[model samples]
Target: MDDLFAPATGAWQRVSPRLATVRRIVIAAIAAPVVIAGIVLAVLLPDQRWIGAAVTVATLPLAAWGGVWAGHNQRTWGYVENADDLLVTRGVMFKRLVAIPYGRMQFVDVQAGPLARAFGIATVTLHTASTETAADIPGLPSDEATRLRNRLTELGESRGAGL
Candidate 1:
């Protein structure tokens, strides 16, 4: 199972560590509401206080685990621009490696939501002839995302991808 993608083969470029910060923020945003709801419920319905306490207790640990997972998961993402293709690798237990040949690329997109923009990170999506091959790499710094988009576009054109 682990032999699928040899992670040691290339000089992989890692996304900024701040990617963890952005992901942690998202996790906290989601968890806080649940905890707040639990607190509110406890205050409003004393008879169901156990439910609220359970919710708070469960949510707090899960949120903390998510924050830790975010950092570990962020470290798993890496990409390498090979001579003929761009390779992206991610995941921990169920790992995946996507190799997008320059000639097969139809377009490249860079996106940043409001929170991501504030965190200075973005996601780069690669579109190919087959929708199944489409992949997105997130947590790239804003500038790197732009540079990667431009480089891929240029490479695709030069490789006669006809984009």
Candidate 2:
């Protein structure tokens, strides 16, 4: 019985390796240059050594924050396509697993930001009848997002049509 479900389970386990939000990357990337510049300027200013030291201290926190952001960017919960439902799980601190039944799904949206477009990725936001149970699955290839959106929409409409 367990073997019977292995293939299905394996399919769900296959997730995009790069699922971090481009927003996270962009923020980190931007911070690196700014922090470096600040540190350089601080070192060059002899009279304002105290102010420079303050700026350098502030950079420490930003560096720590960037590290955390990078860690989050690397972690992604992939989409699961079961026979009758779709599931998405993600998050590190506040882990969430959202299951959307075919009949309950109203629409599926594909979202891409400027950075996401550059990275060739998109997020699939699934809307169901319940607001609280909505699912936002990120780090999908744009094509995959579109395919899933279409498939889910078809499933939902077909199921809803019967009712």
Candidate 3:
């Protein structure tokens, strides 16, 4: 059970550690506003102050939980590139491992939202013929994300030529 999500014994590359901070920031950004709104509503409408207080109190735990989960989730993500395919593994409780063959890749996309850009991280999305086969790896440094996208596109084209 303890080793359920452990990395494979190979050259698995971990994403940038700053991703934890990014996650926490995102969670706070979303949760803080809601909590603040609730507090302000309570102050403005004394008749419904209890409801607002309740909402605010309830959200605090959920926000904290979200931050913690994000940190753990970020730590669990990793990828490995082999001669034939790329392997992505993640999840803390329900672990998942996906093997994407280079020959099957159709295209790659690199995206970075404002928060991710601020953190200097990006996500690389891979599109294959089938939507179900698509995979993405997030939290890579900006440069690494671009490099990976280009490399995967090139490999996909070259390997797919023989197919």
Candidates' TM-scores?
A: 0.93, 0.73, 0.89
Off by over 4 Å in 1: 1-3, 7-9
lDDT of 2 by residue, 1-163 (tens): 3232233453554335455445556666876776777777777887776675677678768767866665564564656787788877665566566777788887788888887878887888888777977888777888888888888888988888222
Worst 10 residues of 3 by lDDT: 2-11
Clashes of 1: 0
Q: Per-candidate RMSD vs. true structure?
A: 1.7, 4.7, 2.4
Top candidate on lDDT is 1
CA lDDT of every candidate: 0.90, 0.70, 0.85
Return model 2's CA RMSD, one decimal: 4.7
lDDT of 1 by residue, 6-67 (tens): 64457779888988999899999999999999999888889989989999999999999999
Candidate 3 residue 120 C-alpha distance from true site, Å: 1.1
In TM-score terms, candidate 2 sits at: 0.73
Residue-level lDDT of model 3, residues 1-163, one tens digit each, is 6455444556678899888889888789888998998899899999889977988998899999988898899888889888888888878788787788899987888999998998899999888888777788999999999888878988988896222
Candidates in descending lDDT order: 1, 3, 2
Ranked candidates (TM-score, high to low): 1, 3, 2
For TM-score, the strongest prediction is: 1
